[model samples]
Target: MDPVTGSVAPRKILIACIGNIFFGDDGFGVEVARQLMIRRYPSHVQVVDFGIRGMDLAYTLLEDFDELVLVDTVSWGRPPGTLYLIEPDLELIAQAGERGVFLDAHSLDPVKILSFARSLGAAPIHTSLVGCEPESLGSEEDEISVGLSPTVQAMIPAAIAMLDKLVAELSFAKKVEVTSKGAT
Candidate 1:
């Protein structure tokens, strides 16, 4: 509830986890999403495992959400299982294609997806991504059943912890305050 107004202030935040489980460590997002499913959260926060479902996620992004927290694999050339919070510049992403992005059902490209969302005239919203460095992304031609590496698997708790903090900040954080003293 608003402290001053004594009215409820609900901020819609979407925690959309995207990944392909068949591609080894690429499944990190899906796993984190699964673990978060059982936990409780404010009604305003929605957690979804958008594994390999780019179209579903794209359409969902059209909804009016105050913010979006995306969970996915990040290959940053660092050690596997490294977590990082990324606040991407939406403008740069929205410049993807003049013709607009067309998402493949099996493909999961958060950048393109966001671009597509913007292309569809979706309003801009606060967006953040909780990412983990992937150790191995198995190929569909070979051993695609390897699943998440042990290193990445152990970091699920850490990811969840990060998400919790992020959600709290996004859901309940106050606006930045600025004041000026004149004629003092």
Candidate 2:
């Protein structure tokens, strides 16, 4: 079921954490998401950690969901811990474009992941990226970015704020749809 179209059973939202945690700031997305899961959200929201697994996202396409929010660490000229909602930037893709190069130490390349998701027809109503600056990408084995810069820690609140905004928007939309259907 395509979440963007709202024609699926069991309204659901997906929050995907796509990053390599051991790599300094690169793991920001996954870490933030972990923190979010500690709270209780509505049953409709599905939070998943897609750490360095690009191909695994393919399976996610099979699920019927109403929205998808992707969280990842990306360099957007902000200080470490700074978060940004990244739209598909052609220039950035072009700058980082190299055949199969993982965006960071992580296994999945960010651009490729988006492209793959599109090819599979997995479109969501609103897809947003929350990113943070990295102080250091830790060793390969640990893959946990260490000593998240002060800026990076500060961005967590803003990131959570964005999630809250999305939740309200999605919930409102669902309510309106139900009301319209009842009227019909």
TM-score: which candidate is best?
A: 1
lDDT of 2 by residue, 50-98 (tens): 8888777755855666556778777656566666765445334334333
Candidate 2 lDDT: 0.63
Model 1 agreement with the true structure over 73-142: per-residue lDDT tens digits = 9998999999999986665565664556777777788878877776776766677899999988985556
As a TM-score, model 1 comes out at: 0.87
Question: Which candidate number maximizes lDDT?
Answer: 1
* lDDT for 22 (candidate 1): 89
Segments of candidate 1 deviating more than 4 angstroms: 1-5, 97-99, 139-142, 174-184
How displaced is residue 28 in candidate 2, in Å? 0.4
